[model samples]
Target: MTDAELPEDLARLWRRPTGSGSRLGRPAGLDVERVVRTAVAMADAHGLAGVTLPKIGETLGVTGMSLYRYVGSKDELLILMGDSAFAVEYIDAGAAGSWNEGLQRWARGLWRAYQEHRWLADLPTSSPPRGPNAMAWMDAGLRAMRPLPLDRMTKVGILTLVSGYVNTSARMAQQLEQGWRQSGGVDPALAAQRYGREMARLVTPDRYPDAAELFSSGTFDTAAAPATATPVDPAEANFIFGLEVLIRGIEATTASAALDTH
Candidate 1:
């Protein structure tokens, strides 16, 4: 195909060139998947900034400039990497039994995916997803919500909400975990005690009565806090709580829509 006629991301992902002449001078052994995979490994090891075309080429035992023959640009490579990284098996919503169950499974699966590939949360969001795997994931979520009495836009909105939540939560957790590790891996109880003492000194009851109450309640005492009252891992607990709230909102909205139609 001519440069102007080159297929976009989705089409480019699956389309094969017509002949050896279409190789764009790419090395005989190099192909698109290997190029994308090499970039992914580089990014996983050293973040997005480390994934230069040169580095990818070096990793694959080729000159870095030659990588351009296979992948057009760094931006395009990133899009491919993200699509490849998140390519998941389609979730069987039928097996999930109910809309709620299906959506819950879908959301949790997405959460797990973000956790497993924390770098995904760092990807640039300048454009909407258009890659094959990205579309497949979107299709899976829509299928999960198919039984609901909701419009197409509403279903898309729900998927957006869930994806945003998962990405933000995963990013925050990854940052916090990195910070914790950087701080010499301090004992959680000791860190909590020090944090409580600092807060008590800085936040007096006269200036912050609510803060004082929380401090006095020993809510910051990681070891002493009741399991039933607070999660052992607050980050994870927050994600679960937020996901449930989103699901409930979807259910309520769909139920209301159904009633209005009757």
Candidate 2:
């Protein structure tokens, strides 16, 4: 579509080459893609705060204002980075053996996307998907649920739930990891033990019975576990566990509908 046909953000986001190639008199070897690529690299290394137009321009050996030729502003560059970060190879949802399996793969893909680009969790949410890659991911999610007996709206709702869950879980995980690093990089097992001990000390059974019981259960004693204990990463283990529970809940809720349709 022509730039005129799309909103200002999308027009810049979905800009295409005009066969004529680089604009006349513009510097050779510099273009929108290069500018965006450089910006994404900066964000990946130093985060969104470090990705000013001036920094991008300096990285590309040009003046800060020169970047205006490619991106309208830092906001526009963020939109581009948000889209480019999802450039991971798309997994066709149709290839799955079952709807749940397809959705599981889709959700895991999103989690991996968050893991790879932690800054995505920090970006402002764009509802209705504002870019091509974002729209493609949404389409993949819908395709994954094609086998569901639910109506389109229900399917959309499910997709939204799954997407929201992945984003929330991934964001929390990133924050926790960041906190862990900031606190002198203590071992996770030791951290868990310390947390458990502190909770046990601070929590009174009469005041908070349920949480007190949990703290008393020795569940958080990771350091005392055997050497052969499961080596799985706790963050990944929790994510997978929560995802499975969510999928099971979805399956149970839709089972009756599937039966009725048959």
lDDT for 105 in candidate 2 is 93
Worst 10 residues of 1 by lDDT: 12-21
Output candidate 2 Cα RMSD.
3.0
lDDT for each residue of candidate 1 in 1-262, tens digit (9 for 90 to 100):
5634646444446544523236555667778888988887777788878878877777888998777667667777878888888857534445778888888888787777776666889988867767777878888888877888778988898888888988898898888778878989976556777788778778888989998887776677754454685547666777898889988987888888899999
List candidate 1 segments past 4 Å from native. 1-10, 15-24, 90-94, 222-234
Predicted candidate 2 versus true structure: per-residue lDDT over 17-64, tens digit per residue: 433324665778988788888988888899888889888878888889
Q: Could you tell me every candidate's TM-score relative to the true structure?
A: 0.85, 0.88
Model 2 lDDT at residue 220: 86
lDDT of each: 0.76, 0.81
Candidate 1: residue 111 Cα off by (Å): 1.7
Which residue pairs show backbone clashes in model 1?
none
